[model samples]
Target: MVNDPHPPLHEYQRSGDYVVGGIVSHAFILADSIDFTIEPPPPSLEEVTVVPKNYQHILALAFAIKEINENPQLLPNVTLGFQIYNSYFTARSTYHATMLLLSKLERFIPNYICEFQHDLIAIIGGLDAQTSLYVATFLDNYKIPQLIYGPAPVMNEKTPGLPFYQMVPKEDVQYMGIRSLLLHFDSDLVTVKGDICTGEEKLENLPGPFFEMSMTGHSYSIYNAVYAVAHALQAMSSGRLHHKAMADGGVLKIQHQQLWQLHHFLRGVSFNNSAGDMVSFDENGELVAGFDIINWVVSSNQSFQRVKVGSVDPQAPPDQAFTISVNAIKWHSWFNQVQPLSVCSESCLPGSRKKVKEGKPFCCYDCIACPEGKIASQKDVNDCFECSAETYPAETQDFCVPKDVSFLSFEEPLGISLTCSAFSFSLITALVLRTFMKHHNTPIVKANNRNLTYTLLVSLLLCFLCAFLFIHRPEKVLCLLRQTAFGLIFSLAVSCVLAKTITVVLAFMATKPGSRMRKWVGKGLATSIVVSCSLIQTGICTVWLATSPPFPDVDQHSMVEEIVLECNEGSVTMFYSVLGYMGFLAIVSFFVAFLARKLPDSFNEAKFITFSMLVFCSVWLSFVPTYLSTKGKYMVAVEVFSILASSAGLLGCIFFPKCYIIVLRPELNNKEQLIRRLY
Candidate 1:
């Protein structure tokens, strides 16, 4: 049945007597030339300009049917037939054509008796999206299969009882083809000028008669639709014939109502087409295939030629989806063969970030330099990041460089000065020890327990040497030795001072009658004081090392541009405990020496011990705030300075007077002078 609504129904003809199937195709014939100046856009009911190439789709469909019918293996003992129709490319005309195909009556009434029995197995035309949609609504009610040759609109909530399959790929996959073409030509700005149905006249004057004009996607879709239907029918027929031969050895049953089986078989069908390309359908009944990208190359004669430059395969992985042959693309004359940039703004360079513009595409952004201490290593970074703890940003803020490691190194000026001072003080202490040895028998030398004085001088020498440990890059061994040695040795020195002060008081009291303090005025008491006080500090240090010992570590957080290699005090409480014990000994010695300074003995050394303890306490008291306030290597410098200054004070203040008496006032060193002063 030919569904032409015009008066000239010359192309409409009945099917052959042995027809087994039907085909519906839209071929518009121009009745009159349309006038563009007509108002109201020419009534929707009027005849419009017709395209002659639409007939090529019809011919392609007929050729496929002919090829399948000639092959005995495809549909044995069966033949295919067709009923052509012209939709006039309009919704209302396509609806009337569908009504006529379903029933011979002029008007469509649901379940009405028909004048003729039309064995229409399937309907496969209506190339326009709107026309197909209108036809699909009616055929779906009766489960008639509709094969569309172009992209169909999404179906509404109404159930499509029949299978409505589209032969072309979806719109998104088509856009991928367009994008590949743009990239092939290196054209950033693309203008899509017309609708899908409108053809460009520039494609005319091609090589062959069939290629006289550019073909739309609908033409290729029609070619594939014919092959798809043929494959489904062959599979259905073969199954039916096998079942009949196995069960009853009878003729195969082929009923028009079994078209639904063909629909189900088409969903899973896969085969090769005449072009040697695999054809199949997705779950949504749309063809699964890649899109071909076409580029228009302009020649010197002002003629354009279409070239295949690329393709986009939606079924491929994301990275390999779109590919193009860039060398084959021909740019416009104005480009001078150079590629064009199409972004909304210039790309952000290195060391700068991209700030997204509001209400704009991702390609449009503002370039911003990275902030201080932060870096953007890559181009067009969304935000800059801060450098790592042990690193610092370079001058350009494009790289992160490792920070310079710093410590109180002996090679530097500060370390050199501290070390020289320590050696100088140590030498002075040695000189004082030598002076005492020379004047071993002198009254002033033997007045303060001579053994205790020697022990104090040796400990002060060790204290001066311990400051060397803090002047260089701290190691684990030095970290453990410096504080422990300082604590133990200084304890011995202060304990000796306390012993001398006690001895002075005891000797002064022993001069009276029946004084019992004479028993304690010997070396035995002084030795016990030094040993017992040092043992307590030694115990504290042993426990401290056993539990949480200090270790060498890098101080990254203390300074921004430098990594300070220093000792990490493992336990703050234990460290302070050591300092507290030393402070306790100093305070006790200071008070005892202060009380005993006015004793009535010409040989009393309490005045010197009192002044030495006062100096020691003052140096250390100032050390705590300075050590806490300073940072990095300077903090270590302050601690080392305090150690040297305090040790020098003890050595100078307590022993300098004795050296003066022995060297300059040698007359006062005799026992006769001491006894005369006592009288």
Candidate 2:
């Protein structure tokens, strides 16, 4: 009788006879048990039969109804009845069942709000997702409460009249539970297959048929749905039967409007079930607890037992949401009980980077080596970075090593050569100074402003000594003193030559009696010339120091593999100003001496001053282009070479002949020999 087709309308009418309200439940009992093609040629009605396991969903609903009826606290003095229907898992059958619940008539009417049977309060159970969705469309128009007991269907539109609620969690929660189980066992590669159940298959040897039941998820949903509906009704009744005024003979009638109030009441309902598990619904009418994860482990006898592995609770915090027993999971025998690799490509090694494969996921990529001068220290790096200027990539391109600190140190060949030359030139200047002091009273020594000659020799000695500052790693004091000292000392040297040239012109003109130039031919004129010319250079150096003085700095960008430590002339303008002033003195001295070169004096120093100034200007003019073209320590070397070469030119040109006359030819150095040669 239970396996027979749905009983006539009289059977369902009997359910409403002694009940104050009716709750209808629909299940796909017959259709789910049969094997049929999904595409062409629909199966005939004769091919379908109810599987006993699938009928458990209907039984669960029935148990809830019986439980509610027995509870005196829920719906007191009234019986809550339920009508169970077989939806056959088809849209047509589910729609017909909804129409039957709506009205006893055969024909359907659109916008049917008025209930033919006021005893029907809420509708529950459409175990198939599509069937539930189809039934929900019509029930929503009349503001009916539809409690679905299956995978929650996605509803795009909301109708005010349809208050649909779901007892089961959404399908995504189930997927999450399955994903957590797979991740727990570290099983990467997995195979999945699905089979349809035929009614002819024998379930005798199966483990209670519950494990093999295709609608097991729906059965559990139905179990929860029954308890949910019972609780909702109990909350609505509040331990009393809700009824209107007596219709006849003290029998009370329930209004359709009053039954619709269950929709609002059910939304706020929450309670613990028989298992002490809390059950509640969110604002979307979906269960909040999500799903329970079950692992089906195959036993040694080839029989399978279900193990509770974990649960996915969406309401909980993310870290506490998906809990699982990782050790309890059992993998397939073919996998050799080890985790499998699931990536599309192996990971990139150190010194290599990942190149993502086009039209593929991020997990799939190609490994490429890092470019030259760049390195990837970590494995699977997406990009490589370049080394700093003072560092270089290692052989494997996995790390950067610091390059050696380089400068014009005194230990190096170039630095040693420049130092030796500076010292040698200084010694020669000292010798020349000693010779002039020894012959201080001689005619040739005192002829060309003797005081100015001493000043020039001292300045030349200092110029040679300043070259030593450029031979080592620059310090702050060295940087400040190097250029400034070079400028002032060279200025004094050129100023002395200018004074001598002027003295020679004045001495030649003062020979005429009563000439005004006689007064300017003394030591006062030469002293004033040297003092005033040197004072202007001292002022320029003072301004340069006050504004933007030079400091020690390292050149990291100029050289690829070395840090060149040198002086950074803080202001190029001031640096060139110093050089320009010195050149100005040299040029003026050269012109003066050139004009006075043919004067009638045997001891004329004009030709020597002109040649010395020419050499000074030539060396400096060439120094500019050479200094600008060089880099690193070579730049310092070029400047040092220029200083020594120019200083030596001035010393040999201006003072060497005077030394020769005073030391080697002492007879010619007397005043009589000088006056006789001049006349």
Give the least accurate 10-residue stretch of model 2, judged by summed lDDT.
Answer: 29-38
For model 1, residues 579-660, the per-residue Cα lDDT tens digits are 8899999999999889998886686578888899999999999999889999999988998898988888888888888788
Model 2, residue pairs in steric clash: 140-162, 143-161
Residues 1-679 of candidate 2 have per-residue lDDT tens digits of 1222254334333433111111225421111112211111323556434232344555566566566567766544545555455444456655665776655453356657444655535677554556667777877765677777655556565624345687656556555654665455433232221111123221122222221112235555565666676677666555234343333344322333355676776788798776677778889887766555555666678787776656678778878877866566564454355443433677677799999889876556899999988999887778999998879889999998898788887899898999999999999999999988987887887777677788889999999999988887789998999999999999999999899889888888998988998878899999999999999999999999999999999888787678888899999999999999999999999999999989886866788888998999999999999999989999899999999999999999988888887778888888788778877
**TM-score of each predicted structure versus truth:** 0.57, 0.53
| Segments in model 1 whose C-alpha atoms lie over 4 Å from true places | 1-349, 359-364, 367-372, 471-475, 512-514, 600-604, 663-668, 673-679
Clashing pairs in 1: 21-81, 23-82
List per-prediction Cα lDDT, in the order shown: 0.70, 0.70
